[model samples]
Target: MTTAPASGFQTRRIVESAAACSGAVVAGLSLMVPLDPRMMGNTSALEVSLTVLNAPRSAAAGAMLAVVAAVYAMIFGARVAWCASFVAASVLLICAIAISGPVSSGSLAIVNFIECVTAGILVGALAAATLRRPGVGTAYTVGILCGIVIGDQLQMPEAGAAMSRWRWLYAAAPPLWLSVLAVVLLGVGLYWHRDQAPIVSESTVISNVPLVPILAGALMLTVVTTTSEWTARYDFGAAGLVCEILVLAGAALVAALLLPGQDGTLILLATATASAGSAVVAVPHPRWSWSLTLAALALGFLAGRLRPAPLVAAGLTTALAVYAVLTCGIAHTYLLLPVIGCTATAFVLGYAFGAAVPHTVSGMVLGIVILVAPCMIVALRGHENGTVGYSPNWYRDPNGTEGLLPPIVAVAVTLGCTLGILLLRQLRPVTAGHIRRLPGRALGGKFA
Candidate 1:
């Protein structure tokens, strides 16, 4: 008897999907390049403000805009065209800006800010396109983790005295390369596939969006981020610690109440676990840290291929919990634990993100904010307390063991995620439909 050919997705689709997902790597690099200390030269304050503070805020705003635009375009049934046009415009602007030499701190900040916003759009677009597709989602998640590690690993070459022709070109090389690579991969993955009608028009699509929840979530994110930045950087003392906990709790509350059904819970749990896992790997060792990060990325990619179940993600999260405990307990005494933790945590983070890729644009945006907003607070707590795993500096790791509070926070968050995941498994679907249906529901659309 003749066997039937395997079907569901074509080989071309997989390749294209991988290419699209890999654009995330480039997007991640672009987000990180401005944060690199070497790239900032002497602009430390400017760098911190842009990279650590404004970057997350602007990216959150951009992602929200992406959600709106995607919804609007989908209503008009021109999502592909709209997304392509927006992406093309953003890429071109990024290239133009990346090639320009920074004349002053002010100008450099503006340039980097634009790049971050554009990169955010790229991220939002990628999530909208590929997160639901298992193979591509895996690739996308792995690419993101790799980009972070790669950006940290890459060293800028010094400006040689002998080369006098174009000094700015040498300085701007990394960002320029990143911009170009992103454009190429995105073109191959998403641009080329634009002709195919991927998103089907559904009669059940909600025309009137739930603006209240969306705005409420955005507001909560802004407050938490701004407060965290000021509190941590300004040394608010005990009050800061209390405020931090309150704000984080508020953010979570807003996420759960504002977003539909379990999506909020899902986003909160997934990103919290991923962020906690990252803290486990924040070592500054040049050689081993770099190699282990790459290895983790590779392992993550393989794990994604397996399309691990929620249970699998929960198991990996348990491993991170153990790592978090060890780091909090004896990381300072053992020294080598962080190195081992780096590999394990990074791989598990990748797997967890892949396994729980958000299904909605709002979920994606909220997840990003949830991950980023607490970073400064955690870093500051670690720095002040002299913890073993947390590196205060966003760019360069000086191997300073700031405080164990970071890992302790990580342990709490990871445990919450594991519990949430297991609980999610037992619950029936709570919502009427995907959040996409919320678009026109309030205004009495047919389905509403």
Candidate 2:
């Protein structure tokens, strides 16, 4: 008798199901933990740091586990690898607990238990679906169940800590759990369908030759440095704005380069970057800034539809201009005078550069980088001050004691810049006409 080949879809479905179940369990546990009010404080700088700190260590651990599981599946077969990895993780957890010492603090103990159980469940589920044999699935299931049972043994206090914190924690945990679950499901699907063959090689994926890690690292370092400074001074008005602009410019450059060739991927990455960055920036003027950023993104989409090249160029220019206006004089003393004049010069530069670049994704990326680099550098430097105010605060008075225009103006300018880019893109021609032939024609022409 011959063994039947496994279908990719079926394998993906199995992995996805297992991942979903694991995620559900983790999310349920997260809801039981208390929330930290400081995590959502008025200061964006404080809020951002707290958020990162609150993230379940399970997330990082799970990712590492997933990678190990993938390798095990390829080498020793799925079943054995799964069991071994699960056991290894368990042992490591125990060792960590021993080194950390018994959880003397009750709240800390409960939090640790929740994190551990969730991590165990996710790792087990991932292993069960990807491992070579069905038997190990039972072991993985049992291990997760056992971990949860142990978690219950930790016991919860009936009362004491602030209800507000608890409510916040309860509200926040489920989403984090859900996100981790989704990631697990995606990972399993990718792993299960490995036989379908990938467009890009694994080596290329791991190497990240396109400098994504470098960009991400730089952003992370910037956040950490900015956060530290904000903590020391508690003043992040000008500096925060500068950082926000630089981050936007850097993200725009990344989007232009990484996403130009791929529509769906580009959209996903761009949206994630934009949403996160906007959330950080929205701290100063939650209502107006948020509205403006959303509007800009919407207009960007429209511009892409009408004229991708010009829209790309415009985005690059706008990002740079924002950075320059915010930080040039303060941070870039040598280039300050020249940059102020080049504000107008950028429009001509964008137009010519957009027209000259090849209509390929790579060209679009290069153009965005060239357009934004100088501004980004200045913004990055300017944001070092630690003071951040989204918009000017105002006091109401019948006698005209209000000064609320700065924030409003910022939002309006942001919107206007986005719209201007859209107009520019709409006017640029799609010059890839020569290569726009039907697939069959192109293939035949190539062969001929």
Best lDDT goes to which candidate?
1
RMSD of each: 6.8, 15.7
Clashes of 2: 13
Tens digits of lDDT, candidate 1, 1-448: 2333344346656764555545666555665555543444455564545445445455445545544443433333324633653474356446555445444555555665666566655655565455545566556656656765555434333335355465443233234544565566566554445665534345544545435445645665566556545644566666666656556645554555555445555454554554455455344343446567677767774674467455576666666755665665555456576667666766765665545444454555455434433444344543442321123334434344434555555555555555555555456354565431112222112111
What lDDT, from 0 to 1, does candidate 2 have? Answer: 0.32
Compute each candidate's TM-score over C-alphas: 0.70, 0.33
The per-residue C-alpha lDDT of model 2 at residue 356 equals 31
Clashes of 1: 14
lDDT of 1: 0.51
Q: Which stretches of candidate 1 lie over 4 Å from their true place?
A: 1-15, 36-38, 42-53, 66-102, 132-134, 148-175, 188-220, 234-243, 257-261, 287-325, 328-335, 358-365, 372-393, 415-448
